[model samples]
Target: MQQGSLARYKLYPSSLLWLDSLSQAGKDLRARCCQIQACDTDMVKGLAADAHRLLARGDASGGAIVLICLADRCRDAGELVLAREYCEEAVSHFSCYDDCRHAHNLAVTYYALGLVYQSLGLETDAIGSYDRALEAFDEARSQWMWAHECAKRMMNECDEVVRWIRELRQGLALGQPAPPLLTGTLVKIPMWSTSAGSLLRVREEPVDWVDVEVSALGLANFALLINGNSMVGLGVQNGDVVLVQETADWPADGQIVVVRMDRMESESVLKRFYRRQDHICLEPANERYPFLIVLPNWRLKEEVSRRYAQSHPERGLEFFLESSVHCVGWYCGKVG
Candidate 1:
């Protein structure tokens, strides 16, 4: 099989040889054309000729298959205009039939058309073609399991693009000034234990939406409700909601940050960050809780001496592997 023919077969397995009228010679010609490494202008023209002959013989399915194969090849070769034309032709031929087999063919053909339109920067046209493909796939689903599965996957892929395009269009239509405030969710912090400075486990539950100043907090921000008074010396108190700016960059020394300790079950905590020569240190604002040290190799080691540990029952800290520690974001300020 030629590369183009193989690609078409992989994309539309159910419709590759659905036409009963396709001669062995015609199929052989398609395979031969597709196998050639370099498909020059003459070779492409020859494939087009074969497709035209199939259509002339009233073999719409066969012709559409050939056209779809050509479209795939042209698109791969960066011939968008030719690819679009071939896809449109294939769709037209597939539309002439009404059976389940032809419905599957139409589904694949419309999907190919969508790809062409998407590559050409015609997002609206691409979305329409994807919708048509989805509809055709729905019509064929009872009799064609492959079409149904393909349609489901294709719909998943197109959904995000369609949403982004619609949002862009809406923004352009509105032509309004950017909003002054951004909405951020305030999330509850789960406690690790009854210890005052213990690690806080962060969950995905949003407690409520808080309007934050766009100039101050930016768009990517969230609020965490303070659970303990470990950082009271830094002006943070229990019941205070700390605003945080989401970032992937390393936090500066002495900056407060939300740190996640990666374990089989990950846990998070807020602390002041410090980078030493050989390890990183997470220090609490109050002196009661010992500072947690993350070694150069990503292991968490505590600085508490045995004598101090014996005196302060709640002062002991566990060793966390360095790979398990990540800085989620820097603390902005207390949320009003």
Candidate 2:
């Protein structure tokens, strides 16, 4: 947490440890946590007792800090389940306190939870937690950065990257790009297709089709205005239109594809597809966004949903969540 240029000084001024740095404060807590780490079942009971005592004392802020530390201690000690429970409770307790007072600590608390989730193999949840931590840290930095800028009369952003972001990316494989694969085909001839066939399935379908050229693709291709910055790492900026070729085929490793996850009504996500041994991995180019792991059945989803909706006219529009990843097409290239 202390790796950043600004974080070294602004971590805990007067709130948790007064003038003491995190390392200085951890000495006593670490000693006791080391003792708690030895016992198997008793560790859980001991920490629970410690948390209860801390909370019951009416110092909610202090209790939250202690809980966060205890949660980290549990994480380091290989007690994954206990780490998750305690860190979550710490977040719950700390949430009542004003954001101005404990934003940085709350960010750390969320990071600790992300670590626990990563340990348990919940990759998506881990990334989601990290995203939350980043948001909290951003909030925490505003006041400190503002005060420092005011003192110096400088109008500039702090250039240092936060420690948690770097640490999580390295740990979660978010920083590493997948290895390249050889493909014989430089370009495949796409079958002549049009937008007329695909538009029938969507409820709020687009009426006017733009003639954004996708090299040679026609009837089988579609366009989407990129909505989020999740793919900024790929030079895909927000509001830029992307051309996609219509296909339901599973993409080769590291191939970018447009797929709708969770529901048919949901907006499609542009991601790098990697098929793992167990689950499918759909990763975004940006670290700020969380990647997905799913086993979707898009065809089954369409069948069941359309049947249910058509069978019951009085129900208006109600569909089951039968899929998690519905492949819209493979990404052709960015148009705008």
Candidate 3:
């Protein structure tokens, strides 16, 4: 298309071709989409040191779309605030076009905003935003079915959130924290030495509950119990203890890890990490599990290491004892 004709469509200003049908134009758009995906992948892998770069090449509308995409990426990457900001930007993008497209975008944006608000502890505002998003979706009729469907899902989520909010409110009114149902020692305790002697109890209290400080072990602040022998060589076996850390930071190279997959209640054994300048490689001790590399610098390795060292002086030996230390933390034998 001619330069003057291109402006007539008012499509993305940066995109030379406005139509999506042309093969070359499709290729260009796909390429731009790929660029957005690449940036999102980096954000997901926690290498998003400069988020602005993701929007630099795109036009205003393109930037808004990219930001929305990046918000999803950030959510997956565990960067909640950044994700929220991106969603907000997407909402701000269609201020002039307050038609169906605007309503659809606002619905999606507000849904995302609600999620971020809920995560950030703004429950009331989250619910309100979710309600507004639902209303926006209702108003965006006959515009975009996909966006409408997304709004429907968000509306359903509101029901769940409302239940949670009500439960929380009841707790607050009662001046008590919501009681955990399965209360007796929700954590796994590992024995000090694996010599088959009487297991040592790390906690001196009457042991009604086992509290493990997971973050102190160079892992995320969470723990999981391994129910299989898939991770045997790494001292994790069936019924063995596994600890997981969940933070925005990525794992270092060749460190043992626990990853909660797409559909599993228990987080499975991820592999030891292998660090690189650009990415961190996960290598499972058992060859059955394939190794994969993710963008590096997801986790604060040095900080985790220093914290782990301060917490467990004896366990620090593993760093020097093994060719590579993938995991650092105290593990105890799991008992009823």
Which has the greatest TM-score? Answer: 1
lDDT of 1: 0.59
**TM-scores for all predictions:** 0.40, 0.39, 0.32
Name the regions of candidate 1 deviating beyond 4 angstroms.
Answer: 1-196, 297-318
- Local accuracy of candidate 1 as per-residue lDDT tens digits, 219-243: 1246677778789898887778766
TM-score, cand. 1: 0.40
Task: Compute the lDDT for candidate 3.
Answer: 0.41
Clashes of each: 5, 3, 22
- Point out the higher-scoring one by lDDT: 2 or 3: 2
User: lDDT by residue for model 2 over 52-126, one digit each (tens)?
Assistant: 665786655655565665554455456678878878887887667554336666666776677678767787787
Residue 272, model 2: lDDT of 73
lDDT of 3 by residue, 1-336 (tens): 222321221111111111122233222232233223222454333323222443354344444544554454455345678867776766675444655555555565666666566556666766677677657656654454455545454444334333444454455445554333111212333322111111122222222223432111211223344444545675666554443323223333333444322222221334555564544444545544434434324354555455546864344211111212223222221322
